[model samples]
Target chain A: MATSTPTPDTPAGPTPTEARHRRIGELFWSSDPNELRPWEERFTLSATLLLLLLLLGSPATVPTTLLAVTGLVARDLLHRTWFWMAVAATFPLGLLRMSWLAWDNHHFLLLYWIVAIAITRLAAEPDEQLRRSARLLLGLTFLFATLWKLGTPDFRSGEFFAYLTVSDPRIANVLVALGLQDGTVVPTLAAELRQLEPGADAALPIAPGVWRVAELLAWATIAVEGAIAALYLAPLTSRWRWLRDAALVAFVLVTYPVAPVSGFGWLLVSMGLMATSLTGRRRTTLYLGAFLAIAVFTERNAVRNAIEQVLSLLPGVG
Target chain B: MGAIGRFTGLVAPLALVLVAVLQVWGVTQHDLSQWKGGGFGMFSTVDANANRVLDVRLVTEEGAFPLTPAELVGVAPQGTGRFVSGTLTLPTDDRLDRIAELAERSAWYLDEQGAATSDPSSASPQLEVQAVEVTVYRPVPDRADQRLRFEPIAHRRLESPA
Candidate 1:
């Protein structure tokens, strides 16, 4: 085993404080290539596409168009320096002009902004250090999300997801197909909403089955988030790296469809994929392909809706 | 790596940590909501006590009409991101304010888009819309879809010029 002991070049080992910082750094920010695998160039490509789609989806504007084209060219040529510079520049541009209403644009912009900075650092630092930073970022995201959800009373009781399933049309459609919910129009709400009248307030009931599913989904979300947190933060999981990587992939698969924020999902998967070992060309290709499929699946609404429509047509589904 | 490169490697990780810390603080301040994308606390919590939906409608000089989300997006593309995302939850006071703002913004947009003068030669000339109102709805706990209750929560007039 390579020893932790210091050589004569440094007579004294790291001080307690320095050792703590180094240990924390190793756990969270070390980007050890040996610990995991080489991330494919495609991760950068996927990140670029996410940033591009965000610009495209924003209300048609000159700045958005310019930024999108710049990002596209940078990614196409696989120019990290140019890509990072463009991303760095877009942060303020996006903040100043992009509507605060479409806050996802801001979120995506912020996410890529961090990644671009980390990538630039990676060029100078050891790859492992950058990898560790990426892992730290991903880990903190999951950890904070889990904590926030846990702190919410509704999420604890599954009421949040329950309400979403009943109120959100997309989620309701899925629930209806699964026989967990019945899509009956609320006559009172409808009657109160006469086109030219002062609209009235209304309440709708949720089926017990739907509630049960909501509870399951709620717990599942917490579980997956908690698991992902552990995967990235804990060193113990490295011994059983396959399990950790599998959980990451599974988390992406199970959660992305329900939430369907493709850009964010791709960013997470790209960062998460680096945690797994890519020992062979074939394995890496398959891994990259699977993630790409997930990216496409989550991003494209028509594809998901078409699949849902076909599934809803099955016998016993209304 | 040169001196500049080495300096960047040290700075980058620290910057990321700072960003994460600030995001946590923002959440505590409620300055930001939902960590749905890859940043912080999105869809992590809901204000369950405030369980009411705000259905927005536009009030014109001619009459009041419902403003669907799609219409809002079409008219005020800039303000529709969170509005579209917020469809999954109960409408809050902040959200109502946003809707009112969008309605006011879109009122001018509608005029510019010639929505009112689609058939300008009609007997009753279409008048420009003036305000927006939100109809609030609450889910009847353990009740069916038909039993959901709703009422007008708030209304605001557009900032039309004299």
Candidate 2:
């Protein structure tokens, strides 16, 4: 075997502490070769504990703070980035678990808001890849949502009559118990075709030409969905962004009753889109808008309450 | 093979883990000869006293109906995860009993593909379902589901009941 060469500073060899520090520094913390030092055990332990909390699906404020401190320490010593990764990994889970208890998923607001910030910072990078990824994700979310909703016949048929009929049991119980969920005495939207007695149709009170408007809305939704699908591959230009934002808003405005909160998210997205359009700065403003929208909706539905409802329903789920 | 190959090897486990999580998302049980679906995932640990075991499957129909929820009350502090939720479709409970006995005797890793493999005590077992807490998961939201409530056990002994 070839003889090992010693550094000029230490002709014999590195001391135990030096060797250990060097090994640890090289293995875990930083990428720099000349520098070598063990990470503070407190930081390491905090990170480990935070990781454990994530696995256990019981992230708390204490663990969150510990992780933030760890990230700062890591930045100071390692010069490598892990702040976003730590947040991304642990935060979403914490919110999801909290949502499981609360019967709402508002906890996601905290994570999504931070995601917006990260997206803004990342938007500045010269590589065009993140921009592409963001574009794809936006399209994917809408497409999946569309496909999922479409796959449900009741959803497409606007037969939320079952849900609405049962929303208030005292009003609906007698009719539903009779197996007549449709509150209407007649299928006026069907057989008679919109012309009923002088009074407003309780199920649908529309303007004189509203049937045409309703039909147009259906086609408009389909076209907007198609546009969103195309926008994913379309160049990341200002015009496409405007169209996308407008289409999303239109979708929310149109699909008012199905999922009101999603529309709320689009409304906030619209404001940010407008701001981003005006300044063309694109990073901080976009994130702020997206997060603000998500936060607004989610907080309305607390995490713990949502989780409780979801979990409680799970035992006899079928 | 150098750093790249080593990097791929490291990533393999992570990829497997991610796929497993996705599988959890896609988890549905089929009633071998029976039929069903429509429940979310839940977990329960063995009280460790009864040494009881549960075998279950999560499944639903192709036309999975959207959940109609009621005013959600709240989430529970602790629930099932250590146990697999499944059912048996048999003329008798003998096979189920045998399977549960075998399952309790030694853990087996069963994937969605239905492939099972045995590992020694020292081996890192992937599927170690220990408890079977049979529960009713309410799928609709219009009504609040009733649960079998019990007082919290401070320190329940792990020994088997006579």
What is the TM-score of each predicted model, taking all chains together?
Answer: 0.59, 0.36
lDDT for each residue of candidate 2 in B1-162, tens digit (9 for 90 to 100): 333322321232233234323423433221111111111111011111121122222112221111111100011112312111222211123333433333334334433434343423334344444332121221111111211112221111111112
Best-performing candidate as measured by DockQ: 1
Backbone clashes, each candidate: 22, 42
Candidate 2 residue B14 Cα shift, in angstroms, is 14
**Given candidate 2, what's the lDDT at residue B73?**
8
Question: What does candidate 1's lDDT look like per residue over A201-307, in tens digits?
Answer: 33546667766777787788888888888877777544576665677777777766667666566556556544454434443454556566665666676667877
- Please give, for residues B37-92, the per-residue lDDT of candidate 1 as tens digits: 22455665443223434456666765666665566666666646555455323244
Candidate 1 chain A — worst ten consecutive residues by lDDT sum? A28-37
Regions more than 4 Å wrong, model 2: A1-61, A65-80, A92-127, A161-226, A236-239, A249-278, A281-318, B1-162
A1-318: candidate 2 lDDT, tens digit per residue: 122368787576667886665565444334442432222222222233233323323344555556655654554421223564456565655444532223121132223333432333333331132233334444544454344334433333332233333333442544545555554433433333223221122233222232343335444554576576566536657755666655554544444323334423442342223222222223323433453445444444565577678988898753
